[model samples]
Target: MKPKFITISDSIIKKIKSGELIPGDKIPSENELIKNYKISNTTARKTLLEIESKGWVRRIKGKGTFVLNRTATHQLVRTLGSIDSTRKGFNESLKAEGLTPKNIILEKTILNEGVSAAIVGRHVIIEGPVLKVHQLRYADDELMKDETRYISLTLCPKIDALSTEISYFKAYEQQYNLKINDIRQTLSADILEANSNKNHFGTTSNIAIFVLDSAVFADDGKVIEIEYSYYRGDKYKFAISAHPEYGHKSDD
Candidate 1:
């Protein structure tokens, strides 16, 4: 039999899936869960943590646990720039749409040379330690994307010691006196199995996801960082615009 906490959490998840509990709606408090389910304080807390871990809800300190819009649609307008620039653009867009934007650092570690070469590209030689950072991004309290960034520690020695919640570019400029010169990025898509990502994205199998790969360079032509990102397809729309002078002749 499943644990009591898991059973309780699943029941709440079902309500969220059924739309009986809409986004921003507060879930039962710890005391309420304990009284309603006859569970202990520890079990009640675990239940809340489990649901939050699955991206179905968010807990605000001193406030309350609230439902998140796991299926809300967001828009991404691609432009030529570094990851930091793209992040700033998205933050502004979310605000303009009346949504709150947040970035949560999930994990950070030092990448070995072998692992670094595989993800950061074989062509990029690893001269020093590489810092790998994993982050979850959200809009209006809804999870939107998972991002992984690999930074060259040799270029910015103090990066590994800083908090991942801060803007990387800003941190570099302020702490290391470095400025990003350019970035090369690529976009692709893949279908993700619902069962595999249900806990990560709170969705069923065979879901479409967008992937973005980027390499960042400094003004002196040295590579500074690399990024691999996954965006939920059902929750995001892409927009692109071009000028005739920058490309092909106009039809007119």
Candidate 2:
């Protein structure tokens, strides 16, 4: 037999999909649901928890539970490395949602442009020439992001000669015996368009909020690669840990 909470959860999910319940709209409270569905309070509360876990709704302590204002399922944990490596991290982040990360390399080239101020002290591969690589990332085949990376071939010679079978980071290790020391990152909102042979983003084609940028440093603290990525805005959200700012103290 179906569990009482599971049945109620399904009913709520149905209403959400049917447009009867819109984003930010509050559904019946736990007490109301218990009386209306003839279920116990435990079942009512359990149903709400289920929906919240699915990221379909939010429980505002003093306010109430309401549908989530979300468009697509995009959850990213920032990590530094090659496309393959990032995909691995993405897969883990989306695992609970039953989603898998996938990608298609769109282009790879040698060029000399596109470095920004934030990465100034670090060598910009563009100052001379670099290996610029582009790829489209997907979650379970749903287009999720576009990545553009710039790597300094001057410092890591033979980098462009590496086999495509291995990840760029691993290739760097094999070719230059280098290791990652730290990573710097930034996030922002943007939009995407279907370009080249990439159309997996779907026709709706809305603006996206991307992780924006990142800089990876070799063990010696020299920047080896800088990447800028665009993510589907409707499907992405950012989470940051907060800390209180400390003010200057008087000299003792």
Candidate with the greatest TM-score versus the true structure = 1
Q: How high a TM-score does candidate 2 get?
A: 0.50
lDDT of 1 at 237: 52
lDDT of 1 by residue, 1-252 (tens): 999999999999999888666555579999999999999999999999999999888887775787765543544333433243343444543443346889887788887572333322335444557888888888877788888888888888868888665667666666788766655556678877878743367675577888877666677767788778888887765433332112211111
Tell me the whole-model lDDT of each prediction, alpha carbons only.
0.69, 0.62
List model 2 lDDT by residue over 1-252, tens digit each.
Answer: 888888888899899888666554577889998899998888899989988898788776765777754545444333332232332344333442345557688788887653543542343333546788787777777777777878887767767676433456655666678766555556655545545234346655444456567776676666677887777766654433222121111110
* RMSD in Å for all candidates: 15.2, 11.9
Stretches > 4 Å off in candidate 2: 1-100, 112-126, 163-166, 173-175, 192-200, 240-252
Runs in model 1 deviating more than 4 A are: 1-72, 78-84, 87-97, 112-122, 197-199, 239-252
lDDT of 2 at 225: 79
Candidate 2 local lDDT, residue 161: 72
